[model samples]
Target: MKKLVLWMVMAPVTGLCLSFMYSPSAVNHPSSKTGKLIISFRNSVDALPLELNKTYINSLQEPFKVTRLKYYISHIELDNTSAVITPDANYFLVNEEAPVSKTITVPFPAGSYHRITFLLGVDSLRNVSGAQSGALDPLNGMFWTWNSGYIMAKLEGRSPASSLPLQQFEFHIGGFQGRDNVLKKISLAFPGGKPFVLKAGKTLTIDINANIQKWFQGPRSISIATHPSCTTPGSLAKQIADNYAEMFSIVSVTD
Candidate 1:
């Protein structure tokens, strides 16, 4: 009777110990606050889905028709109170003119985090690092082989809304060296939650709004006169990319 009781008590505890030893939490020793993160997308200025507005043809002065829109984001970080949860670079990419859904696991020191800070696009390190997968996948069409980098932002459309015909614009904004670097880092805060609690094995879905009209919001409709594509280094791409960086905002989170 004594041996049986001891076995019952030790079996579960022993299994749990071994599980923790091999878990990802063991590498960083995450606290009880650890949880999974869910991210979603929205377009704020206009209800237009980000997917529909990502192409340059979509940016013409008038007669806007969207044939296609796509891009990629890599090396993301989620900022919290006690620690920053940065996932592997193999994570997300915005493609096929569709808003994407992804779950990223961030290991923190264990505590509630009310807000998060992240990148609107990939960091310079991965942009310069050679070939990659997912968002970095060369097959995704966001990368530029001749220039040796990624197209940080892409928009296309045509409308009875503009004056130009067959207008298309492509903005590939990134250059680690010199006047065209377009990586954007953003921080968002949440109120009313004290040390936000993340229970183990649970997932939180967060909604992010990428304002589609943000590119043309402050400025007049992009002149159809500007260069059609960023085949060479110049200001057209830089201006549009800078505009695209300002398009993101946080909408909500579901735990």
Candidate 2:
């Protein structure tokens, strides 16, 4: 009877000690206070599903088919937390072909954030910095050879506008310098500038829809037939980049 009571009493103490040893409170306790941010990318036309290789006409009745659409969004930051989640954890290569690539996550310290900001393209620093892995990896096919920089966005498809042999168009836009600086830093505020609280162990989700219509109907309407690929940095690339400036919009946010 005495031994039974002793074993029971010591068992509780032993379990308590093991719990502390296995928990994160012993190491980087701050990580325990962090939550997750999920950003979703969708290809759509006026909120409808976008079909690849299917002919979709523009305002001018020009028929086009989007065989490929890929882009990069980097250097994301959220306001209201002392802890920082930098580009490496935030940059993403959004590809329409890869359904799993549509969502990107950022781990941040749990707190109330009033604003969120991110770059539309990979910054100049990262492009010339040298080879990287993960989303920025060259094997992903977003990087450009010879020019020694990333192709911020690539749009490949066919259009009746193309009188060429293949009736195809390609736009590989990427530049971080003056005149050709296509990188756009966009800041979005929560509804009514309200702050959204990130609770520990909870994830916050935001939907970002890339409107294809805006690509064909922005400040300057694009005609793939008249204007072909933008393989290099120049005015043509800039013009195409300008049109895509309105490509992204925050559709919804859910906790």
Identify the candidate with maximal TM-score.
Answer: 2
Candidate maximizing lDDT: 2
Report, for all candidates in order, the number of backbone clashes: 22, 1
For model 1, the superposed segments whose C-alpha errors exceed 4 Å read 1-33, 50-63, 80-91, 96-110, 159-165, 191-195, 218-221, 225-228, 231-233
Candidate 2: TM-score? 0.82
Global lDDT of each candidate: 0.57, 0.79
Model 2 spans > 4 angstroms off:
1-30, 80-87
How well is each residue in 131-238 modelled by candidate 2, as lDDT tens digits? 787889999888878878888888888987887669888889888888877887767776666777788888888787888776667888777767757788778777
What is the lDDT for 222 in model 2? Answer: 79
Weakest lDDT window of 10 consecutive positions for candidate 2? 80-89
